[model samples]
Target chain A: MLIRELERLENLLQPWREFEYINREVFRTLSPVQVEFPLVNLWKNEDKVVVTTEMPGVESEGVEINVTGKTITLRFERKPEELKDGEAYTRRERRYGEFKRTIELPFNVQSDKVEAKFSKGILYIELPRAEAEKPRKITVKSE
Target chain B: MAETVKDKNRENRKIYAPAVDIIETTNNILLFADMPGVNEKTVDVTVEKNLLTIHGMIEPTIDDKLTLVFSEYGSGDYQRVFSLTDEIDKNNIKATVRNGVLKLVLPKTEKIKTRKIEVSGEA
Candidate 1:
């Protein structure tokens, strides 16, 4: 459909392309997750804010997530694999090291009501709007 | 097997080129591919005529009930091909898929394997 084509065009211009998955990101002098944004998809409805992030190789044991009302922080580390005694490295593209990022949400959400799920290397987090923060319907007055 | 080849030939559908990491070890060459939504039951790794192909069948929707408000990845099948040479032992290659990471170990052929020379004691 035309919509799908448009979306793909948009994706091509996104910063994700800057990383290029391989080749370029590997050449960066910095180590893992430095100055990088995990592919994130965010949306909001009347009652909740939902965020999904793609993290292929990160494991639960090494990952840490924290929430503070309007912000979320993720931190993790992946150790580098050492080369074998006689083997030589032909290509070095994958990167490994410590990664940490804090993201600010558009609106304040209930910290206690945040629910997270990890499936298929994607992390989904849902935060419900606080009772006080929910918009109340105003009755229209007629003259 | 038939389904995989069909999928490979599937046209007009989105296909994602999976990100890859290649590492060489003393005894083997390892490849790591970031291919989420693919499991052992659905992954296909094949070698034919010196061409190595990796295909991962992915589900279209994770949960149909949950409305997709936005998306960064238009999630689709993962496909990539690599050229293999005599240095690799195609018959003995091993692969494992866990938590969306595909680990492939290609054992080096005997000819390229580095063997330590036996040192003789001084007579």
Candidate 2:
């Protein structure tokens, strides 16, 4: 009797699970709103501004970084994986395509001295502050 | 293993559900999960009794001296779980991490065959 009851409960719950999966799939595919791509974070101290962004599945060689004055631009391309002869994607939530992002800093940056590194699909950039933009410590002489 | 230790430390930390893409072939199912900032050392994949779980730990990349000026995305650990059917070969499942993406290949134990039956009319 216990085994029969358990089987009956399983049969009842199976459709609910399938319904939930289908609901999620429809909502994700039909939603028109989209979030901004390649989200970034910026940090600063005294000498330089550090920026980071996550780009999973992207290689280092495909990324391009440009710095002009206080502005930094990042460009990259994420290619979609090709399916084999009999393979088909049942669910696809990851985005893939060409992407470009531009960031402006509050202070001027040394464009030539800017450095960037890519590892494990994360982009790290350091933009040194321009010499003229550095905060100068004013000395108060005893009068 | 180290998995238990990390799970204990996850009390106050936020966990994010990483986006994934799942593909199905004739003999295998493939799953790709995006988990940036997690490398091989911090990722754990396990399967027990038809339950598959994926966990990836992330260490803060920003230095202590640096103050966040602007932000858009939050850094956190990634975790997801899925239920598997008995048709999958659980013992032979393979997982690999590359460029912050985790790929899991689950092979089916047997091919699902379709049989067509022929009907004969009695004379």
Candidate 3:
């Protein structure tokens, strides 16, 4: 009986160990990408799929959004001004240039009804499901 | 183990600029630089005599409407220079910046590829 409890405890800790191992591996793989940029989160609700991307220092007008089939593309470019030739720089660290990212949608999205909003350096995209793809309630009667 | 420890110590030594992480893959080399609050036009990347230099300037964030409650990230310009060896192809260095992340893709030159030749006795 005591051995059974120990086995149960080991089984509970196994998942935690696996989680730690996976987290460490991900960190090790991403260690070379030194820039700590904002993260993107995607979630699916009943009727719509939402995508939120954190893009600080980017203006709403600068971002270009395109949707084709089940894929969404985002493209933008940043251009900073030049400083005086005689001026000296102390510490400078900020990324500037064109960036493009494309994501595939899990389900078929209604291309015509897609909505995009940008606020506080965050871009939010809402993709509603087509009429045929949406879930419908069905009634069953016993024969 | 001792050599690895020494290498870690060497990497820890701070220079005047921020440390950059450069990752080399099969197709390109991704350059991740920590540059806070730097915009597009202020950033300059140039390669001269096999020396790659990344210069960035961060403008101060001063908004009258927004009230500052707490702040942790610092605001400063970033400058780092890397001496590139013959491993990187000089002609095909491409750079892109997005959301404060600078991605540089350095393509390898054809001359850098290894070639095996057959050895035969002279006829």
Candidate 4:
């Protein structure tokens, strides 16, 4: 009797499973796979290098930043929006998932001194050049 | 149904059509738009007649003193338009911006029957 009841429940859920499959196919066709997420911009001055990336609707706690020598890695996860019963999405274009990106800087940075700030869903990171890596200026005196 | 319309005003800065998700319930519609770097003061939403428009202005990240060494994306403003129908109560629309995302709630107008018509049989 238990086996027969489980089979009946499965039959009832068959249509919902097919609907989920169709939904996945529709989303795949609308948006293609991208190699990178949260694309970044890098800026440099004499003192430090600044990196910025836009990640709207993401919490600061979900982001992880790591710096090793001249390389920096960013890892983050965007949580999916939840829907209540009877609510349906008419159109969807936002992308959400776990993303990881590694970037190489021009020179070694002060890993311990790196400063990062999140404001208005934009991540700003300032990596100061290591004291030993920066070029030193020397003066010459003629007698 | 919502349809996008082109804006007549053109500026030097590039304007992007921000990605949006539209959800519908029995009583109202919800819209979420991603416009990074835009805050409440910089974002604007207006409804005129049957048209609704959204605009968000973002400041440039780089200045003259700094050289952009590497970039994978371009900076721009956000603008999108949608044609609304009479079903939506435009006067009661509510909007908010948080974490660079805009959320809009459009309430559905109440259905009203102005008059009842009677049918008569003809000879």
Looking at model 3, give its docking quality level: incorrect
iRMSD of prediction 3: 19.2
Summarize candidate 3's per-residue lDDT along B1-123 as a digit string, tens digits.
Answer: 998996676454322243344554444455656554455676789888766778776543343333332222333455566767777787888876665556566776667544568999999
Which of the two candidates, 1 or 2, achieves a greater DockQ against the reference?
2
Task: Supply the TM-score for candidate 2.
Answer: 0.82
> Which predicted model would earn the best TM-score?
2
lDDT of 4 by residue, B1-123 (tens): 122222322355666667788888767788899999999998999887776888998877666788999887778788777878787888999999989899999987776212347998998
DockQ of each: 0.29, 0.46, 0.03, 0.31
C-alpha positional error of residue A65 in candidate 3 after TM-score superposition, expressed in Å = 0.5
Q: What are the TM-scores, per candidate, against the unseen true structure?
A: 0.75, 0.82, 0.41, 0.78
Docking class of 2: acceptable
Off by over 4 Å in 4: A1-35, B1-10, B112-123
Name model 2 segments beyond 4 Å from true: A1-33, B1-9, B113-123
The count of residue-pair clashes in candidate 2 stands at: 0
lDDT for A105 (candidate 4)? 93
Q: Which ten residues in a row have the lowest lDDT in candidate 1 chain B?
A: B60-69
For residues A49-132, write the lDDT of model 3, one tens digit per residue: 776665655778988988887888888875543444332223234456787777777778998999998643456788887778
Error of 3 at A88 (Å): 4.5
Cα shift from native, residue A88, model 2 (Å):
0.5
Error of 4 at B109 (Å): 1.7
**Models ranked on lDDT:** 2, 4, 1, 3
Looking at model 3, residue B66 earns an lDDT score of 30
Kindly report the interface RMSD of candidate 2, rounded to 1 decimal. 7.0
